[model samples]
Target: MNSGRLTNFLIPLLAVLLGVIAGSIVMVISGYDPIAGYSALLYGAFGDSYYIGETIRQMTPYILSGLAVAFAFRTGLFNIGVEGQLIVGWLAAVWVGVAFELPKFIHLPLAILAAALAGALWALIPGFLKARFKVHEVIVTIMMNYIALHVTNAIIRFVLSDKSYKSEEIHESASLRSEFLQSITDYSTLHYGIIIALIAAVIMWFLLEKTTKGYELRAVGFNQHASHYAGMNVSNNIVLAMVISGAFAGVAGAMEGLGTFANISVKAGFTGVGFDGIAVALLGGNNAFGIILSALLFGALKVGALEMPSSAGVPTELVDIVIALIIFFVASSYLIRLLLTRVKKEGK
Candidate 1:
């Protein structure tokens, strides 16, 4: 890699390293063996097929959610509504998966597409208001989240036959199950959804780097006034960017509802994948390839945390603390850069 590329990668890598080291210190101070805790963490995340499968299952939605947040960040938008978008999308996908009967291929795709559409529609209201009325998107999106929650709850109660907060199991045809793979992984729910997530990431990268539409969207993001002066439709681009971002978030919901969870439950307030996406995007520097690694790290961290309390006698909340430290370090990268520069000068 060139110097600039190397430097960019080094920033986050160093941040993560420092965060891990600090976490180790915390473990030591707490009277736990830091080495043992870390060893257990690694073993829990990658030591067995079951653990690996679970890691992948968790990573699947993370990839999509990371893309969702990353894409919006690229367009200079802070999309805080990913949580609501994902929840509603999950509800829509699960409803369609259970309500429909068709060929497996067709049914599955339809359900996923419905979820994407639902997410896009949810984002559109804020996008439209922001574009047309000059409303602040952040506020509108936050409010939409609550609206999505209550609206979905009411729909589940009155419209669906099932009075339970949960929807019925999706038709087998629409489910993204792989019996052969599941057998190999001891019935872990990792399926074809990983492939879908990868494909979406590739498409997103291509869309951002090699398309006129992407250029227009980014131009508007950089400066709406300049873009408008240049004869570009800034308002339209802003709306379109949010719509596409929401579509990505929606697919994340579909992955969980159709591939991971057999059904959707209204009582399940939020999966938090959308919120996690923000951290993923930030840690990854909003790059497509970076997002993959970031998502994997987070997925492993979560899975490892589940094993920590039982095996290492460390609280699972330690993982959150580590993540927070990592984020803090990343956010203050200038400090790290300055220190590195001072060390280099001293050596010189």
Candidate 2:
């Protein structure tokens, strides 16, 4: 890697190492065995084929969600409404999957498509307002999240009143399950969603790195005024970027609905997947491959947290604390650079 990219990466890796060290300290002070806790954590994440499969299953939505946030960031937009977009998309996917009865090949793709379109459309509301009126996207997207939540709840209640809590399970025709994969993984919930997520990550990477539309979108993101002066349609690109980002978020929702849960449940609050995407994006430095690895790391941590309390008498909250510390250090990466420079000067 070039010096810049290498530095960009090394700093974050260092931050992760430091976070682990900090977590060890916390465990030691809390009357917990740090070594035992981490041993349990590692064992829970990969001790068996089943646990490994579960980790990958958990990573499915994370990859797509991270890509969603990364895409918006690439376009110089903050899509704070990923939670809402994901919810709506998930609802839409489940609604379509349950409402339809067709061949698996046909029904599955349609359900997935429905989710992407729903997410894209939800994002367009804020995208349009920002493009047309120059409103701040962060505020608009945040408000849109609450609107999405209430609207989705009402839709769910109205359409599937028979259940009264969760939507009906989708027909098997629309399911994304993979019996072969499950069998191989010792009957874990791991589905074909991982394949879809990997494909989506590739698409996102290609779209950003190897296309004219990507160039324009990124150019618009970097400097709207300059792009406008350069004869680009800044407004259109802005809206387009958001739409694409929302579609990815929607696909993430579909992973849960069609692949994981196979039904949509009413929520008293926003699903944490969207928020976690932000951390994944940050940890990945907004790169597609990086996001995949980061998602795996997070997935392992999440699954491992379940074992900590039982196996080592460590509170699961320590995982959250470590994650927060990692984020803080990453956000303050300039400090890392300054320290590096000081060491270099001292060596000189």
RMSD of each: 2.3, 1.9
Q: Candidate 2, which ten residues in sequence have the lowest lDDT sum?
A: 322-331
Q: Give the per-residue lDDT of model 2 (tens digit) for 1-348.
A: 886787878976886777778788877887888899888888888989988999999999999999999999999999988988999999989999999899999999999999999999999988999899999999999998899888888888788656497889999999998899899889988999999999999999999999999999999999999999999999999999999999999999999999989998888999889988888888888899999998998788778777888888777677667556655665565677789878868998
Q: Give me the displacement of residue 63 in model 1, in angstroms.
A: 0.8
**Per-residue C-alpha lDDT of model 1 across residues 1-348, encoded as one tens digit per residue:** 985677778877887788788888888887888788878888888878888988988898899898988888888788889888987888889889988899997999999999899999888888888899989888998888888888888787666545777677899988987887788877887888888899999999999999999888888888888999999988888899899989988889899889888787675466678888887887777888988998898788778667777788887677567556665675566577778778768998
- For each candidate, the alpha-carbon lDDT, in order, equals 0.84, 0.89
In candidate 1 the C-alpha lDDT for residue 246 amounts to: 93
| Number of the predicted model whose lDDT against the real structure is largest | 2
Number of clashes recorded per candidate: 0, 0
TM of each candidate vs. truth: 0.93, 0.95
Regions of model 2 farther than 4 Å from truth: 327-348
